[model samples]
Target: MDEIRAKKENKEYDWYVLFVKVGYENKVISQLQSYFNKKMILPFLPKLEIFHKYSNGYIEMEYKILFPGYVFVESNLNEMKFISMIKEFIHYYDAPLKLLKYGDSYEFAMREHEKSMLQSFCNIDFCIEASTGLIKGNKTIVLKGPLKGRESIIKKIDRSRRKAVINIDIMGKCVPITVGLDIPIKLP
Candidate 1:
């Protein structure tokens, strides 16, 4: 708790918690990391960018981070107090609960990450390849679970949601589905 106004006009706080509007989480996280040593959790997102390889083995890269907003922050009481000094436009997600529950510790960081980290949006073909290396497990590039027959290409990866465009041979139409970074839908 920092006493910005001490003595006669003093105000005290136990901790701090805040939520950045969509697309602003990164801005705040970057600023905080550079300015202070406070611990923080910014749910990382993966963006699909086009990559090309030349015959000479020259490689090119281009992409964007998928998810936006929805960041969970954790830090020490003393360090977090500095958040008050921030003048950016942001709102508190769960101010008291976040402050009381999370702090400067590995457990706090891991817990926050587990709660908001990547979730599988949809399953692709067996050897499905992504521009990023976020995919996990023995599934390799192939998505695990029931969405096996689905061979779709990522049409758009938005901060709010991911759009996968799949061409249905039977229907002869493209279908788009929104999926997170988690395992695709379970087999029906």
Candidate 2:
């Protein structure tokens, strides 16, 4: 348990992203957790809590994957072995486990800064909890949570849905991610 956490914090380990079926992010993480040693692989799927309204007219909170079809893992294992493990999973599930590649090399891993930004957004449990903030005029001020001090990245806010859309760099591409934002108050 702590061994994995320690290794993740180590600089030698690299972060890699795997593209799987959209709905299988959690399943793939679970399978990887069982197949690999905890210290060798730290699989994570960033999730966020959102409010859902049921047919009974009641609202409940639920967790949703922040980036569908992608799972990030920090590992110090050999690239060949990691590819083989992904191949094994592809064979077993009959679903593709495609590792994101850069340039012509399949071993290309995410840069340290990219990984650091992600780590800052997600907590130890790999979840981005709702950010509490206030809206005044045309500005959004995040008082707490992962989005604090990161208001510049916010492109739009939907108060009804309690979601904020922001763009972040992933695999050298700008990807828009929706995160939970609670604006409990508004000021003139």
Candidate 3:
């Protein structure tokens, strides 16, 4: 059985970020997963864009790199020699070490975190939606918080008491919340 400890030392699967060509994250992930099943995670991402159908008869659209230049890899800390093969398969710009921790669970958590961060980077950094009393009709900027600078469009509201609801879609999950305003809300 796997042990869950309060703390651990050393880890397998270090966090890394690779700058790569757009639309290739999955390709790299696929190649890697084919070699290391259940041992990897390639979170799906959607780049929602407002397309313009020009009167001049051309349709143009913008694409957001939901997960830009990154694909998270999970591996044994003591075994990272073949990680470079991932770089080659993905045609990556480069691979860089992201963080170091003292235990296995922590390290695993960090690896998952890097993956989630990569997948959510653009959306969380650009948009927010608030649907709450008092804060109604107000597009509150994320002045400061865990999601600092990450803005979204208001989808629902309940602002009678200095609160707002923000929405975020992560790894294909929708997370809507009642949050703060002009205050440093403590994060968990």
Candidate 4:
């Protein structure tokens, strides 16, 4: 079974957000994977597909980070020693780490709604797929992708750019996330 699936079946870990240096997301993820077991620490960096237009009507597809400089980590916070070890390791690499806080506790975690939303974007292989939507008489309809049926959370939609922006509250701050989508289907 895959690591995420196994972790879901066990239900022993809680999701936490780690703030790292910009452009170092991949490096930190690699280091974390090497130092910890899949169950002990699972790092997730959600990505989306974007298209770059060329001069000759040729468009190139590329993957971009959905949330830059932040990585979601799943682990059991009860394991204080393990948490400390991770902190030390991150510090050793000269990467500053900030654990999200809720109220006065350091154990602030992702809400069920947020977790479900994120999980919907990820396939069984743990890859995040780009979402799709349609335009129907001034209304946006998500067709067959992760963003489907979750329109309530969408804050804005840039039809020209084919992107949807959603605001999520994380660690007491509202973070705006921009997700790329394919050209919308216009309904008659």
Candidate 5:
């Protein structure tokens, strides 16, 4: 029981952000997982599920990176050891992998609140599904999905494109992430 509790607490707080070359996020994740066993480290790439429409009226579901070129990781190793391990393993990959640093210093681990906020938006697989909502007067009420109770974080809503932009502060930077939202009903 104690072991399980400790692990859950560790997962909630110990997330590090890595910046990989654009379009090589998956490659880096796979390489890291293979290099170190899955139990040693877990990499997460949050994706947004959206619908793509074709001229023939066929709609297809597609996944796009919620935060491109960035991958979040939870590892059991200490900070220095983890950094050393990643630095050594990075040479094997074709793409570049660097830990996100601030102002000439290495501050890789995310704050607990930041990780918690991200987890709330993403599911177990780190995917943010499309949110269904209704427009009531000037307000948007998310009836179902990850955005349901988090409407206050919405910075802008593009109804036609079915996307909502939310500003999330991660690694001490405010990033605007666009997620899928469908407001099918409008009530006066």
Candidate 6:
């Protein structure tokens, strides 16, 4: 019981942001998991479930990366240890990895508030489903899911492509996240 209490009291991990090759986010995650103990590190790539339309009355569900080239990781290890682990992993793959940086000196770490916000938005599965929204009088109204109450974060909505481009601040830098939306179905 005391051990459990101690563990709860000492939450040592912070969410760190990593920038990888645009299409290599999943590959990097797989490599990290294979190299490190899965319990010691948690990597996340926010994905969206999109419905692709096809001719002859066919629709297919597909998963798309929400933020291309960016991945978030949570770990209890200290910064030096984490960096060392990443360096070792890169050495094995012969691919370069970079942590988000501020100017030239410091690594940009995600703020607690930002982390919590992302957690709430992504939930435990780390995947956001396509939301259904309607455009009325030049305003977009989300009808369901996490995007409903957080409409303000959306910078632009692409109706034809059914994608919402949201602006989020990470470590004082504004980054854009693109999420898919289901085409609005007309109510009968």
lDDT of each: 0.33, 0.81, 0.41, 0.71, 0.80, 0.72
Reference-based TM-score, model 1: 0.29
Tell me the spans in candidate 3 whose CA falls farther than 4 Å from its real position: 1-13, 40-65, 82-188
Encode model 5's per-residue lDDT on 8-127: one tens digit a residue: 654543678888888888888877778886766788788888766687867667899988999888877778888788778766666777777554677777877787888888877788
Best by lDDT: 2
The lDDT, on a scale of 0 to 1, for candidate 1 is 0.33
- List clashing residue pairs in candidate 1: 119-180, 119-181, 119-182, 120-180, 120-181, 120-182, 121-179, 121-180
RMSD (Cα, Å) of model 6:
4.2
Measured over all alpha carbons after superposition, the RMSD of each candidate to the real structure, in angstroms, is 15.1, 2.5, 12.5, 2.7, 3.0, 4.2
Candidate 2: which stretches are off by over 4 Å?
8-11, 53-59, 78-81, 84-93, 103-107
Candidates sorted by TM-score, best first: 5, 2, 4, 6, 3, 1
| Better model by TM-score: candidate 5 vs candidate 6 | 5
Which residue pairs show backbone clashes in model 2? Answer: none
lDDT by residue (50-101, candidate 1, tens digit) is 3444678665543443333334333334343444433232333222112212
Candidate 4 global TM-score? 0.80
Clashes of each: 8, 0, 21, 0, 0, 0
Give the per-residue Cα lDDT of candidate 1 at 27. 64
lDDT, residue 78, candidate 2: 72
Can you give the lDDT of residue 8 in candidate 3?
26
Better of 3 and 6 by lDDT: 6
TM-score: the better of candidates 1 and 2: 2
The 10-residue segment of model 6 with minimum total lDDT is 1-10
- Give the winner by TM-score: 3 or 6: 6
lDDT string, candidate 2, 17-105, tens digits: 98998988888888888888787888888788766667786766788888889998877777777777766766777567788977586
TM-scores of the models, in the given order?
Answer: 0.29, 0.85, 0.33, 0.80, 0.87, 0.77
TM-score of 6: 0.77
- Which tens-of-lDDT digit does each residue in 1-188 have in candidate 3? 02211112444434444444566766655555565434343223333332334677564544444345545444443324434444355454343322223244333233455345534533432322221122223444455443445555445433323344556543334556444333223233
Residue 47 deviation, candidate 5, in Å? Answer: 1.0
